[model samples]
Target: MPTLKLAIADDHELFRKGFISMLSNVPDFEFVLEAANGQELLDKMPGHQPDIVLMDLQMPVMDGMQATEVLFEQYPTIKVIVVSMYDEDRFIIHMLEKGVHGYLLKDTTPDEVEKAIRRVADEGFYYSDFVSRVMHRKMVNRLPANKHPFFPNATNVGLSNREQEVLQLLCDGLSTSEISDKLFISSRTVEGHRLRILEKTGTKNTAAAVAYAYKNHLI
Candidate 1:
């Protein structure tokens, strides 16, 4: 497998160093650079183009939110995974709106951190359980009166009930294995459903499919 280059941007020197040390042990990850703040990360970006960035939300200069915006705006191919201590819905939703590939807590385990990096690199998103729950709750709470949260455009689009169930779980940020477990189906079946949903919605990926559903007010 190809190694993924990584960058870390946090204001805390000790935390940064410890993260770097932990990541260095992961076989598939290559630590390319480190930054004390968002501006520093940006300044180093031109010189070292990492495939993924582990960003901290709060910093002295530029901050993670601004840095994430600028990074994606300037280099759309690079992926960003926001690793912060904040678990508030606003922070999670704000980063999601900014198009981050993943959201992780600061207290995340080394295994989950590695998993998040690999998942985001491969699957285009890695929403921890907390992040997914928060997003689902917010979206459900914001639904208009007398409209089904899972099928806003059910009549307009001929999505089957099973597909809607799959899509809703996807929007909740459940991985394929998790979805399969929850639905009592095989992972391959879940993947087939995912592909069909993408095809039906004319989307290129899971993220785009979810975006289409939300854009058309499906979920």
Candidate 2:
């Protein structure tokens, strides 16, 4: 069987050690590297490109968010699974926007952590039951006519279904190629949808277009 190479970035030494110890017992996983913070992760990345990264959200010398941005910019194929203590919707949305493949709360059991690694390594998404519920609630509350606090807008220049699908994936931080693969569309078709989305939403770039979609409940 092929081993899945993994790295971890966290500030707490004990937690990092504990995580490595737990992962060491997993048969299919290989803990290849560890870092204390995002900057260290970046500094060490060129030498070892892991298949999966377990990252803590709050760290010094560049937080997980910053690290995610850099990682996506440089190594788009590396899947990052956030293993943080935060469960807030805002934090989850932000991480999703920054392109994290999975979100597992820090208090999750070792078995669950192992499962998440396997799941994300194979499928590119891992959400515990609680996390899945939270995501569902957020999505339900954000429906255009819901009139909830999280709802962005009710009636706007609504994007087409395909456009909305692309926009949601984009907001979730999937790249053009990834989106194309997920939707089983051509890259050129995905690019065309993105351009039309920007034009319809009056946004300048992918980021702006995503912001507009979220702000307008188009996604």
Candidate 3:
């Protein structure tokens, strides 16, 4: 079986090592890079090409929030799952805003960590039940912001029926191939719809696209 390259960014050495050790025996999992902080993570990522990253928020050199924004702009292909101790509503809401594929508490189970890795790897997102419930409540209570001319017309965005279908499936966390199988369409066709949805909604990645769908009540 092909290996899945993984990386972790954390300031705590003991925790970093322990986290890696916990998953050391998982099949097909390989650690290609490790970083003490977010800046270090960015510095090491270019040559390593990890498929996914387990990020921590409170790093010394550069925090996860900054790194996440940079990663979103720089490495759109690399998925990130924030594994932090903080579960404050603001922290959770902001991470989702920054486009992480998943979020997990640092105290979560190794099984959950492994499962989250596999889920994000296969589905492009894995918002566990906890995160889902928190996000839904927060989004519901969010106050309406001033409308700005710079924002894409998310509410007014028009999508073909097929594109709408694809967006809904994406919001459901179905990856390209999964959507292909479910919809009986080619992967390339699914990708095409994915791109058009991003363009129409002004989102850069699937995570952001799903966020857009939620923020705009699209799905």
Best by TM-score: 3
* Residue 65, model 2, lDDT: 89
Model 3 Cα shift for residue 213 (angstroms): 1.8
Give a tens-digit lDDT track for model 1, residues 1-219.
899999999999999999999999978789899999989999998879999999999999689999988888888888998999998888877677666888899999999999899888876778777876776676567556346555547445777788989988888778888899999999989989888887787765565566556545666
Q: TM per model?
A: 0.77, 0.69, 0.82
Clashing pairs in 2: none
By lDDT rank, best first, the candidates go 3, 1, 2
- lDDT string, candidate 2, 93-142, tens digits: 66755657778898998888888888677545665667555655655665
Candidate 3 collision pairs: none
Which window of ten consecutive residues has the lowest lDDT sum in model 1? Answer: 143-152
**Model 2 worst lDDT run, 10 consecutive residues:** 149-158
- Of 1 and 2, the candidate ahead on lDDT is 1
Tell me the lDDT of model 2 at 69.
Answer: 82
lDDT of 3 at 83: 97
lDDT of 1: 0.82
Against the reference, the lDDT scores of all candidates come to 0.82, 0.78, 0.83
1-219 per-residue lDDT for model 3 (tens digits): 788899999999999999888887987999998999999999998889899999999999899999988987888789999999998877886787677888899889888899989988876778776777676666566544344344334356888889989988776666788899999999999989988998998776676677766666565
